[model samples]
Structures are given as structure tokens and as C-alpha cells.
Target: MIDVIGPWNRMHHQDTLEAMFRLRHQVFVEEMGWDLPLARNGRETDQFDTARTIYLVYRDEDGAVAGSMRLIPSVLPHVLGDVFPELCSGPVPRGPAIFESSRSCISRKARRKDPNGMIWGALTCGMIEYAMLRELDFITAVMDRRMVDMARVADWHLNPLGPERRIAGGGVVAVTMPIDTHALDTVRLQRGVPDPVLSLRFAGARAA
Candidate 1:
């Protein structure tokens, strides 16, 4: 199940949030070696993780953080806008109805259990559901080429903002993914998830 954690309910999920940070450290720092300065003490975090950020955390049967992603309002400072502006050909897209997704990762344990990538599919579905609930228009991200390819295979309507560039020893591209019923249905159909993935507890949470 996926839990949506926002400022409205952050105090109730500190342990889960910490586990998410550690999972990020394991994936982005220990495994991928991405040179993130804020990764310290077995936690991967940065300035962007603030009160305004919304987190989607996927938990396994044992309630361990299996995968997670964060959503930051595009109107605020985000990684693509503040750190990798060169990845965009023109101005970085920003608005109340737009969000930037970052720090997406799945734990090794979950990957081992999900050989067919259903966990990733669930996370993606949850994000789309949350976007739909909040009436968001677009989601932007700076993703590695491999992830971009996966998005293509999943049939996400991705609009590239700039040409792919080699960053941190890999091809990375900036893209805007349209948020609509079509995009959500495509992922659900391809992943064999016919039901909504976001936790019902916060599924109806309004945008702050």
C-alpha cells in the first residue's frame, strides 16, 4: 500500500519517513553513487525536503518502506530548477498545478520480491492517482535515460524539455508528463493493476 505523507500528517509518520530516507541513501548513494552532499548518517535528504513536500511511500507486507517518491510544488525551488537548469532548453516550468517528482527509489528487498516490476508500477500509479485527486496538470522530472525509456514503454505521454545530456556518468533528460486519465489507465493496464494504488486514508487529501 502507498501512504501519502504531507505537512498535514507528517508527525504521524516520522519512522516511515526516516526509513524512506535510508532507502534513498541505499539506492542513490550506496548503489548508484550519485554524489549527493546531503546524504549523511545513512540518510539521503536535501534542502528540498521541507514542510511543503508531499511523500508517497510504498510499504511491503511487513510495513517496511519498499519504495518512495517525493512531490514538490513546481512553484517552489526544486532540483531541476535550482540544480540542473541546463537540462532545460528554456525556462523551467513552474505553476500551482504542476509538481516536480524526485528521489524516486525502490528498496533492494522489494526489487528482489518484485521481479516483474509491479512495485514500481504501483508507485507510478499512486503518483498519478494523487495527481488526479489534486487536479494537477503536469509532473516534471530529471530522469536517467533508462527510466525515460521505461516511461516510454509504460506509454506515459512525456514531453521532453531538452536534449539528453551526460550527467554524473549517465544520460539524463528533463521531461514533462501529462497527468490525465489516459496516462493513469495506460500504466494500470500495462502493469496489470486495475485498482487504485493510493492509500484510501489520504486519497482525498486536498492540495495545500
Candidate 2:
């Protein structure tokens, strides 16, 4: 199951948020060796994790956080605009209808149980579903080049914002993914998830 946590209801989901942060620390800091200052105390958080930031969390059958991703309004400070503007040859895409996706990760326990990558697919589908529900036009992200291929396999319509650059010892590129029903349906079909993933309780919350 997936949970949509936004600013308005974030206070009600403290435990879920903490689990998501711990999962991020495990995947990004301990495993990937990212030198993040906020990644202490077994929880990974950053300046971007503001009240307005929205989160999509995937919990396994045991109700443990298996995978997660964050969505920040493009108009606000984001990773591509604030930290890695050089990755984009042109101006960073910014608008009310655009959002920046970042800090996507899956927990080790989930990976061991989910050999088919259903968690990853569920997170991707949830992101697209939330975008469509919020009437977002595009979702921008700075991710490893390999993710580009994954996006293709998932049938997501992605447009590269700039050429790939060697960053943090990996090939990273900025991209903008168009949000539409076609992309959503394609991902749902590919992932074999015919039902919506976003939690109904928060899926219809007002855009932050």
C-alpha cells in the first residue's frame, strides 16, 4: 500500500515519515555513501523537506516502509535549481504545474522480498497518479543516467533537460517527465497494478 503525506496532514503521519527518512538514510547514506550532513541519527532529511513537500511512501504487506519518493513544487527551492543548476544547460524548469522528484529509494528488506521491482513500480505509478490528480504538467528530476532507461522501460515520456554529466562518481542527468493518463496507464499495466496506489485519504488533498 502507498500513502500520500502532505503538509496539511503531515502531523498525523509522523511515524510513517520517520520510517521513510530512515529508509532514505539506509539507501542513500549508508549504502550509497552520500556525504549528506542531515543524514545523522539513522534518519536522512534535508533542507528541502519542508512542510510543503509531499511524500509518496510504499509500505509492504507487513506495513514497513519499503520504498519512497518526494515531490517538491518546482516554483520552490529544489535540488536541480538550488544545488545542481549546472546539470541543466538552460534555466531550471519552474512553474505551479511543475514539481521536482528526488530522494527515491527502496529498503533492503523490500528488495529481498520484491524480486520483481514491484515497489519501485508502485512508487513510480503513485508519483504519476498524484501528478495527474493535482493537474501537474511535468515532473523534473536529477537522477542517474540508468534511470533514463528504466523510465523508457516503464513507458514514461521523459525529455532530457541537459546532457549527462559525471556527478558524484556517476553519470547524472536532469529530465522532465510529462504527466498524463497514458503514462500512468502504461506504468500501471507494466507493473501489473490495475488499482490506484495513492492512499485515498490524502490523494485528493489540495496541491501544496
Pick out the ten consecutive residues of candidate 2 with the lowest summed lDDT.
199-208
Total backbone collisions, model 1: 0
Q: RMSD of candidate 1 to the true fold?
A: 1.4
Cα RMSD (Å) per model?
A: 1.4, 1.5
- The TM-scores of all predictions, comma-separated, are 0.95, 0.95
Off by over 4 Å in 2: 201-204
Worst 10 residues of 1 by lDDT: 199-208
- Candidate 1 stretches with Cα past 4 Å from truth are 200-204
Task: Please count the clashing residue pairs in each candidate, in the order shown.
Answer: 0, 0
In model 1, residue pairs whose N, Cα or C atoms come closer than 3 Å (at least 3 residues apart or on different chains), thus clashing, are none
lDDT of each: 0.89, 0.88
For model 2, give the RMSD to the true fold: 1.5
